[model samples]
Target: MASRKKNPSKARRYSVKEKEEILRYVDSVNSKQGRGGQTAAVKKYGISALTISTWLRGGGASSFKIGKTSSNGAGGVIAKLAAVHAEIQAKEKELASLRSQFEKLKSSI
Candidate 1:
């Protein structure tokens, strides 16, 4: 099986200060011209709209949690982490299955 290479430009992390600055800029623009400032901000900062919305809804980067609690009170960061772990496990299982198939074909040849 060929090895998978990590993409260098996959995800980017921004510092708290940078996020605050971007939020402030977005606020200023929105206050001046009404709505759609988030789109403008995304274009200016090269960040995703969903990320900005998360920051807005989560009350800034410091309090930002990947998953927020629901009515059941069994969510938040822990839930997000668990979800990611499950995804990784599923992907690994698929990879193993593919590898087994490849090995079977190689031996038959």
Candidate 2:
């Protein structure tokens, strides 16, 4: 059976920070689901499960400049929250612009 990582040349390199983030996400998922955290991370991060397994086994730990992460799985959640907040801000600004345009058109009519 051919694995998903069939082409070595096409394999993407993950940075130390990325690896740690993925590991944290996996930890978060596993803590909540009791298992299948790697799979959840694969779907969320678009990474292969084999890569996550290797990292979990310390295959990529030697070069890792490990940093502190939240124990409550807030690392992943907080990043996502920040992204959503930014999007909401942008949408609000757009809505205000559209409302201003509508008022201008009404006054001109």
Candidate 3:
């Protein structure tokens, strides 16, 4: 049998602040679900279970028992959140403009 090779990917480095953010998010989600919210971290963040495990292991002591997570997990979540927020804001502005246009059309008729 031919052995499958793992793809080579460079590990991303994260700062202390960034790591805290990821753990914070994880903590927040875990809190809401009580002991059943472990999957929230991975699902919401699109993070892999293995990656999250690594992060938790390296990111100080966690009250919840998880595998591990990298310090960069927080940064990743923050970055994703920022992007989503920007997209939502942009859509809101566009919606406002469309509503205004509709109002103008109605008023003109």
Best lDDT among the predictions, by candidate number: 1
Rank by TM-score, descending? 1, 2, 3
Clashing pairs in 1: none
Candidate 3 local lDDT, 7-49, one digit each (tens): 7986766555665566777777777766433477667766576
lDDT (Cα, tens digit) per residue for candidate 1, span 39-97 = 99999998999989877775543343343442112355566568789999999999999
Off by over 4 Å in 2: 1-9, 59-63, 66-109
Q: Tens digit of lDDT per residue, candidate 2, span 54-92?
A: 878763333244244322245644655676799999999
RMSD values for the candidates in order, in angstroms, are: 20.0, 14.9, 13.7
lDDT of 1 at 72: 19
Q: Pick the candidate with the highest TM-score.
A: 1
Supply the global lDDT for candidate 1.
Answer: 0.75
Q: Any runs in candidate 1 off by more than 4 Å, and if so which? A: 60-109
lDDT of 3 at 36: 35
lDDT of 2: 0.74
